[model samples]
Target: MAVDKVFDAIVVGAGHNGLAAAVELASRGWKVCVLEAKSTAGGAVNTQELTLPGFRHDVCAMNLSSFAGSPFYARHKDALARHGLAFVPAEHCFASVFRDQSWLGVSADLDTTVQRIRAVSEKDAHAWQAMLADFQIKAPHLFAVLGAPMPSWKLARSAWRSWRELGKEGVAELLQLLLATPRDFLDRHFESESLKAMMAAWGLHVDFAPDTAGGALFPYLESMANQAFGMVIGQGGADTIITAMTGLLQELGGQLQLDAPVCRIEQDKGHAKAVVLADGRRLQARKAIIANLNPQLVFGRLLDAQSVPAKYQKKVDEFRPGLGTMMLHLALDSLPDWTAGAELQRFAYVHLAPDLAMMSRVYAEAASGLLPAEPVLVVGQPTALDPGRAPQGSHVLWVQVRVLPARVCGDALGRIAAGDWSQIKQDYAQRVLDVLEAYAPGLRGKILASLVMSPQDLEQFNPSLIGGDNLSGSHHLDQNFFFRPVASYSRYNTPVKGLYLCGASTWPGAGTGAGSGFMLATMLAA
Candidate 1:
């Protein structure tokens, strides 16, 4: 812990990936130190009392859906358990209510889920079974892919193994599934509008259109499958995961410094030597410097432009953040009632896109930098499941609407500069409240406190979420895979020697911080 002591590695950014990387390195006997700009860890996986006293709300990322399937969590569960992390499975995963008052609830039990679907259409219920079966067969390999780095030969080997196990026809079916859009995929199998909408809404969680090419929708469906496998809430909310990771790192002699904003990564002989902090302090390292920051931030701002490769620089400029989202955290006096089941006290997570056409319109309007007439809303009432989050009869609601543009343009920026953005936010919040009221009556009056975070606030809180995009970069085919961040640097290791990338901006774009940290650890271990 000496001020001048050199560590084996220095991890920039205390996000999940940064914590995971530090833990992995420390576990391997490498002396590590993590630098965080924020006083607390858990970048997006943080919980706070943003509203009234006694109301604990998860500011971002409510579900451990991705964490459930993470090999990192599986391997480190014992260590994590000591830090107070636990999981609670919901009876129902999600409920999507249509404009017409029809609803579809995805249950933890596949049979129950099928029955729920059958209420809408028997044929669709059967199709739902087939989809689950197919996913069950393919999920293991898919999960493996998600845990490792992209274009990995190891992953390719697993794919080959799955191919052999599934045979040619099954392989063909998998290929077809990957290529088909969610809209077409659902239409071919389901007849019920509500059932199709529910599935499509789940697929659109990443804020991508169901019709986007290269079938990006598969990952969202895969996310649901992963969640259903081992859906458990962490002990003290998502921050516990970060706290556990930090504890693990500390146990292995890894060091961490909070409120240390890294201004630059100093290099020597084409390799990272140390990080320059904003306070003008230089902390040197001997082995590697891992950046858990967004690729755009790492390359575009933190590293000296003269030292970066021209090609990489171009890609850094070109890298596009995925759609940003508006997060509304509400502290309510009571839980909202659902029409599907009166017994439902909490919505584990709710999907609000009613149908494919509605979803398409939402995407279209968002793409144009305008709020949708009916935005796709994802809601989570963690207090319903974890009463400890609030006082008796109180609840906390986390609502998010994926938006196209992270920043306001000409007129909108001007409006914000002129204090009109507050009005805009109020207007938008009302729209969301109106939707909530229609689906769950008496929701508005129960609000004792609320906080609205614009896209600008999100970027300010986490620079990695550039343009307020939580996904790092768009998951579009052009920006994914070998093309991610840039073509040659998609594997977490960057062009700068001993400097790496590990955030949502890397491969597997966003939602679920499982892949980035695990993959970076694997690469470093190798």
Candidate 2:
């Protein structure tokens, strides 16, 4: 019951961010120890055979475009790559199919993509070219702001540089892009509904809907970035980054303690000193304490009441989690035969949202505690990109139905009864399959086996996915940027001395970038 094990730093939750922190600290000879609640390292990025044997499914996260573009990966690329982490890029990043059997998507080749857009509107094709050109000019400054820590001169300097580069009119356009809705931005540039709908779906991946303010930037970034640099995913599963990061951490002499859920943060003299494990063991930290958790979990549950101020507690209480998501992992006999034709098979993501209005209705209905009639479906056929996932002839489908209420009260279409997720998850999953079969006929028949994780199941799998929100917290205007997690702690430094936050809950929020952790490591090392 009594042990004395001291470390230079203690990192909580062995997610990408937590592992990153451990690796960086150990690289600096900090003698770090990482504590993860789960049995394995990867948090949402874990890979497993959810449906059947040999059918590897990414439980939560699948895309690695953000990770591949991250400065964290950039700094440790060779080391990570040498650890057997391979990335397979998509030829076609994404496609959105319509009820009329027409589809629109973006590919690695600009000419091929332009031709696709030209088929709908020639003017929009030129607009795509112009947008990429502008991105080339503004990307350095834009990404600098996104990646830089908030409440610092680093972000300010980047913004100033952008202002000088863009001048008056260009600055106004940039502001409009940042402030305007996805509908406004796309309608301003492109004339086709498919082009607009195709790109706007990415916003749903975050907190934004098509009409949500502060949504324009996500669509622009995902589309333009994919065109500039192809979308990359782990070769076999999304957990490849986790494997590589764990290897690096262990190689640097850091210890990863699995299945060790930290019950409380032990503080003394207004500084976080150690974490008490669930098994009544206390792991002491001599230097710093890093929490890879949602602010609510860290403050509301783990830390002492007096550890944070009243105002900060109120902010944490007000920390809104985005909409819940339901995951459908399927081991299919073959990939869904999209009615839009064979070309659609090359893409990583095929969105079933027909237009902006449908996406709007889904967000509205879900927020009102009702599952949408036509839920926006992100049908991911990962096996298309990597043929090594399943049996030689078999394939796997990673389907995510967006904008479901965390606690479902009723279905918008009035099909499923309002009840606990345990009772209705299967029915809800069937609803998702209904929509998928509509877009991609014969899809339902191809399923050899399937597994559905409800919103509650998601929360149970990882407490960070509060109310099944994969982004950790909402990415709305008031809660984003300098206001992320909260205004006072936006710089990753908490109110408590030597306590740092690093996770999806922090800035450069969400996805598998490992940005926040890497940034903290860089800051603390300096």
Candidate 3:
């Protein structure tokens, strides 16, 4: 604690990844300090009473499918659980509602889902089962390839195993799955638009569109994984993970300073040496400096321009944020009386879209910096899974309006003014609600209160969500895996001595999963 002595390490940002890094380092008896710009931690993964008093809504992240399967959670489950983290599971995980009001979704049991597919097409039912079977065979390797640090033995061995398990022909098919568009992938497997639409809805969760290459994996994993393990939400809110992480960090002797934003990373001969705080305080790290930030922030804003290499600076400058999103939180007196039968009330999420074309149209329109005529909506009724989120007999809904422009330039309807999200966000939220009303009649009447967060609002709340991009940066083919940030430092190490990077901007980009964090922690700890 003395000014004369340096700490073992210092972490900037108290997001899940930063917290994970602190936990790993502190557990090894290293003295650690974590600085957070916000008053509290959990950056984008937070919960708040945004709509009304007593109605707790997840600020951004809600689903925990990736977190449930993440290696970080696996190793820290006991500690997290002991610190008051509880997850509620949903058997009927997700569904897609069409214009005709018909819906298709997955169930906890594969046989149950196969039966539902049979109702649409018996051939599609068989194909659905085949995909699940192949996933079971190739899952271990596929997950390894995703979770491990790129260009490492772990990734190399995982791919090799996949090639071995799937014969040459099967491996070729798997490669095609990786490269194909979501529409192409679906068309190759199923005949029913309803079935394809249900799975393709998963692509919108990320920035991927129907025709976007490297998008097939999201829909494939979403459908097959839901059938395998279903979806999970925290008991009370998404911050249950945050609460538990903070407790774990504190217990491991890591100190956290809130509202202490780092002004710059002080470099000594091109080596990361210390951090200068906005308040003019200096914290020196004896061992390493880890930043859980997007590449733009870490290299573009936080470091001296002259200190970074030209190529690295260019790569960071070119880092593209994904399409923006709008979040709608509603406090209702009762659950949505879904027309798809009350069975939908038992599911976790219901997506509002007619088919893959609708999803594509929205993406195209948004990519053009215009609001769409009809945006794909992800309607989450977590109260169906965790009743503790609202007062007794009442419910809360989390709606994500996908494929909005980061910088609005036009409106599909030509009603709203151009490039002014702040000017028309409320009207936009209403349009989204109107879409919801089409699928769930009388949904407008059930609302006691509502909260709308525009893309600008999201970025304002967390500057790291630059331009309202929740995924940190785009996961397109050119910027993913080994090519992420840049191919040179994809292993988490930086050109600066004793500097590392982790978070959604790093490997295993996006999601609440702490892959990059845990991976970097493991490497540094070793």
Candidate 4:
């Protein structure tokens, strides 16, 4: 499609958030155009044949539970379904395998989960049931805070309601849980070390280590929610939501330009007026412009020095990114025959972090720029839930090596020399496979092909994943909520008028939640 000289909004980046904001504006009868540097849409939320022709792999994100339950999806569910969006439900949401060759899995069926917990520890099984019972009362209050815009009147209202319903004691307890570390939270709730290990792995999904404060909330929610509502992956790949959103946008008369990167934001008297493309094409925005990139990229690179204050720019510079990740995609002739049991083959995710102590050690090593001796592996069995991702009778594995340094200094094992990513990625990949092969004995032998995406490769694939921080920015208490990107601009508005920020870098960070995008769109359009 030809570029319009002007539009009501010109969104930079064709990421899910950018597309979402565009779709919302277009639906409100505004002319919008989304510009993406890459030929494809979906930044971290993409799927491709990275390994072999018959094997389809979700490049970064695989779980769609967040997107499925998002307010954006809720509002446009029928429209999305009409655009070919579908999900495959998993009765077995996730599990954790131990060095002892035993495993603990969570099933959608509460009774089944209780049984498994009982097999581990009868006391913990009672504790598991107790947590589930409390979840019914607590989840609504927790979701109220997470689903609202940070530091907004809506958030205040949510707090008021929680106070009214729960009274002083309950609200205080909620605050304590929110501030607790993953290990602290687990220690307070359960007795079994393996059970605690199983839950703490949820922390690493969002850059939380076992000892990181403000990490407990994620593990609590994931455990409770999976037990309550089950889990869902996109029918074919994680990009299903992206495809649906783009379809909906075009259906509403919005324009999306691929291979069009914005080089500069044109400003007039401290007001964003237009954007200059990399190809030297100038296009004007009549009303607003939304940037779905990290704040550093936006404030430091895209905008002129005079456009933003020095203090604000410094804050953007100080906005920290979490530890890096390496993605491994495998095309296997058959799924891993787990030595623990074949029952482990049925679940969606099998985490390989053995205990809380090891989880803490890995995070410390990664933070110090050392490759962990034993990195935490999130082994995803998407093909188990959706066989269409691979050829008939074959399977695909999505392995995420979490909590690694973006820059390598040395190896903790002291075997592989410290070098650039290209020099050591294969050796590192083999180490990851060796860790997995211990649990699934013949894992490496069944591989038809494999693709290793180092942190550098991830950044190369999508610039928004700076340093391969898939969450875009850290989710620590100081960097989260109202402090995201920066404390002053937490509501998505910039110092420059008519310009805004959104995406994983904003409040309610990461995953396929679509919270930040939907929240920003509703605010702007209103």
Please give the lDDT score for candidate 2: 0.89
Residue 132, candidate 2: C-alpha displacement in angstroms: 0.9
Candidate 3 backbone collisions, by pair: none
- For all predictions, the C-alpha RMSD in Å is 2.8, 1.2, 1.5, 1.5
Q: For each candidate, how many residue pairs have backbone atoms clashing (under 3 Å)? A: 7, 0, 0, 0
Give the per-residue lDDT digits (tens) of candidate 1, residues 10-102: 999888877877887788888888999999988888888999887787877788767766777777789887866677776667777788777
Q: Residue 349 in candidate 2 has what lDDT? A: 92
**After superposition, which runs of candidate 1 have C-alpha atoms over 4 Å from their true positions?**
1-3, 215-230, 339-344, 408-423
Reference-based TM-score of each model = 0.94, 0.98, 0.97, 0.98
What is the alpha-carbon lDDT of model 4 when measured against the actual structure?
Answer: 0.91
Estimate the overall C-alpha local distance difference test score of candidate 1: 0.75
Candidate with best lDDT? 4
lDDT of candidate 2 at residue 217, scale 0 to 100: 93
10 residues in a row with least lDDT, candidate 1: 410-419
Q: For candidate 4, write residues 452-474 as lDDT tens digits.
A: 99998998998888888898999
Residue 355 Cα positional deviation in candidate 4, in Å, after optimal superposition: 0.5
The residue pairs that clash in candidate 2, if any, are none
Tell me model 3's lDDT, rounded to 2 decimals. Answer: 0.87
The residue-level lDDT of candidate 3 at 471 comes to 86
lDDT of 2 by residue, 449-477 (tens): 99999889999999999999999999988
